[model samples]
Target: MKLTALKTMAATVALGVSMAGAAFAADLRIAYTGYSTDNTFWIGVAKAAAARADEMGVELLDLTASSPDAAAQKDAVDRAINMGVDGIIIGSVDNRAFDASLDSAKRKGIPVVAVDTGIEHDHVSSLVQTDNLAAATIAGGYIVDQLDAGTVLILGGSAGHQTGNARRDGVKNAAEAAGHEVIFQICDWQDACAYETTVNFLQSNPDIKAIFSAWDPGALAAVSAASELGKLEDLVIVGFDGNPANLVSIEAGEQAATIKQDNTRMGAEAVSNLIGLIKGESVPAFTPIDGILITSDNVAEFK
Candidate 1:
């Protein structure tokens, strides 16, 4: 009877431990979304975020919009809500179009973490991205240094897009304040559109000395356009977002310079903060990642 009692107690203890282990084994599910993957910037963000999610053993459901459409991202939020994701990480398409779905997510007790482009919603638990204005100010100042007295064209993203606008303001403010003539055009963040704009603008405004593309892909477009026009060496081309190709272009003498935003770090930090928030830890409302100005001088390091 004593042996039987001991055996029964051991069995009961094992059952309790097994039940506790089962309860702890439920893994977290995260839904990751981005506005566009057309640019290398977002591509880097996705890759880094995925790697971090894997490291954390979290199941990440990735989604993205092909274009800068708010509806797509909002729909993604809804889907994530329906799927009952534990948390959300998103790079918004626009600042204002996500509040409704985000609010819905809040209603379901799911926290949202915004990365890259910010959504102007109070419900976002945290934000991770580079300081756009300062980065672009550096790029714009570089452009001004290259040009003495000729018109400069700025290839910008969506009109009124907060991130793009900050970059635009930075470059324009620095360049104009330095006495360089500046003109602007919107490309909606499309590389092809930037290429066409550069080609067309250069034809009519051949005296333009330099171009500042808000993103690195747009800078590549400017490079292609200038090379085709046989004026590549004559014009100073500066791009934002130090993508791999941009670093290559800087090293290969195809492009002038770029503001290298640590996109991988941004994504990784987003995941980190989201996990912290899920664990009921305190995190900052806004997290800013610094950028590096990449020129031939330091392109080797980044490469």
Candidate 2:
């Protein structure tokens, strides 16, 4: 989908809903646990979810983890179930770590909606997230087409993570198919680690001509590393998660492009779907939101 259309849809979802006579919304309490509180992406999701919950007259508990701790996330879910919330929304740090907690919620008849990260559980009523593999393929194709020749470095999320693996493979597959050599590194979703790795790797490998980050912060970290090494203008940098800060970098020409996810829509849709489940209504099992690749050429539309 186009960037403009996605923004318009988010606005409509935010401003078009009627506040009066939301009978199903009354007395509804929803609990949401995000991937982490430190990331701007999750912050955006929390903000949108809170706004939508308010519009629908539902009480939302933002129980986002202070850091990327899978244990904390599971505990938060367990707490919400103990509180007897009508529904729950989760952006899990580790999707595989929630079975026990989610099972308890299921026994208590509490509905769940997984967002961003896919949780494989029977209790989850819906999944709302970006098509990460497809979006990363687009970013990789851009790198291959725009750069003449050189190795590409990929800074990815934690190993064995489903979403991270999909993104990593998407870019790796595209670049390798185009005959561009690719190098990979796991940043464990830490900006400091990404920065250090980029610096050390670039110091040893001058043949690297492009960088792809699985998330926005790592992209910014790469930009910083390249700048400090006087190689900022020599490399093409692209990142995932259309973070507002990353867009600023794109506008300044510090970065080339980023795949922007519909975080607002994901948050609102998760809440909406959970409410439907709470009301004994059916909602789609999976909700895939489109991502737009924002570059200096089209960054104005997003801003």
Candidate 3:
């Protein structure tokens, strides 16, 4: 009887140890960085990614920069590397500035995946982003189709940011393809800056018929500028990112349209790619998420 009792206790203890080992073995840490949580679009992406990480039994540590400063972002990446995370995901302010840091992460045996924006270096294991250029082209085409005969103004983001440049090029290409002339200006992605630039542009060119902004805030700025000038009806404003605020503008007829990027899908795909890399599975280096053009006609669908 004593032998039986001893055998049962030994078996129980062994099972307990095995379960603990499995629990410890299942832990994975991922570091994520992006622009800021102040924007609803980014907040939604972060929340969905966190939920996905929970579902996958992995731990995600979010590291955000105060602003869109590359130096601060690089610091966040370095901190993540020092923490020895299994993988790191970044939406870089500048694609080329992080090459050395990415190389360092690769040397540390950590896979790096870029989300929403890309890195120029080959050290990044994968990239998951929306087709920004195509989306911009769609926005431009929408604007051109809406207005009959008037000038369209382009409000762009920072000069060096690759995403901003791609968006600008797309809008320009599409507008030219449609045989419409575009008056373009760079706003550094700040709402105040965009507002000021838009107001100035409107003052100088009151006949501006449409405005296409590369981001939601910039679009809102254009809307505000137009409303203040009592030209909201004459101006058709379009934006990217399909933010909740922009949706309100669309519903109110203050803004014409926006391009919706599936950021949740972006986050989930990035995590999946990282897992594949961890498992030694071959994964595509670049993954492009398609965008949907949202206008008042189909804004309900997006909501």
Candidate 4:
């Protein structure tokens, strides 16, 4: 959509008015596919998307994948396409794995809006996600400012995932630039793996002064591991995806900082973008939402 139209959509969605609630010519059916139901962040995204769909009087099909795997998520998209939904919204498991399904959607004239994870397909109308690189840089800068130069461990997301890679790169760039030795580990977005990795890494590298987790759960896992190893007091911990539990950790002074994404806004905005594309209106290729860096000094506002 044009800049003016995009602004109008944002205002309407943000204010619950602008024009989102207006009657549509026909009932629109949009399929929403989240990464997984058990994930806290995706749960919030799904709830917001459902709320927005309700506000717009559209039918939202919850075709969320049961597992956090490329095959399962791709299957969900295929199901949505076979059902002939007007448009699709996805928090993709792997952006590169949906080529065939997205091509089919394009052939069928079904527009797609991606939330969180971006799919680089012409059929995908827009991507609404956190500005991860910028947010993680801020988080990294916070870590750099808080501690003396030393080893900084990064608990990263799954390999090859765009969102996770960006977060990893952001922090890595900042830490390396500041002359801190960086240790990287891929948790594959798994809590158990993160916990184990943190414990093992800290055991061998006692001089490590800080840890940056790409996701909140990973950060919490780090907190747990550090507490078990008696390293919590000596380390500065930072995380992304301001999950409630991580915020609680911050409130308790366990985690030093986090980059909190507006997941709710992402969901609602994805819905708005999908509707626009369904109506044959042009939508922007990307919409970057800023993340708030939550620290102990201001964790209360988020908590």
Stretches of candidate 2 exceeding 4 Å from the true structure: 1-23
Among all windows of 10 consecutive residues in model 3, the one with the lowest summed lDDT is 19-28
Taken over the whole model, the C-alpha lDDT of each candidate is 0.87, 0.91, 0.84, 0.90
Q: Assess candidate 1 and give its lDDT.
A: 0.87
RMSD of each: 4.9, 8.8, 4.8, 6.9
Clashes of 2: 0
lDDT of 1 by residue, 60-168 (tens): 8888877667788889888999999889998887777877788898888898899977777778979898999888888888888878778889999887888999899
- Candidate 3 residue 233 Cα shift, in angstroms, is 0.5
Q: What is the TM-score of each candidate against the true structure?
A: 0.89, 0.91, 0.90, 0.91
- Candidate 4 residues lying further than 4 Å off, grouped into runs, are 1-26
TM-score of 2: 0.91
Instruction: By TM-score, rank the candidates, best first.
Output: 4, 2, 3, 1
Error of 2 at 186 (Å): 1.1
Pairs with steric clashes in candidate 3: none
Lowest-sum lDDT 10-residue window in model 2: 15-24
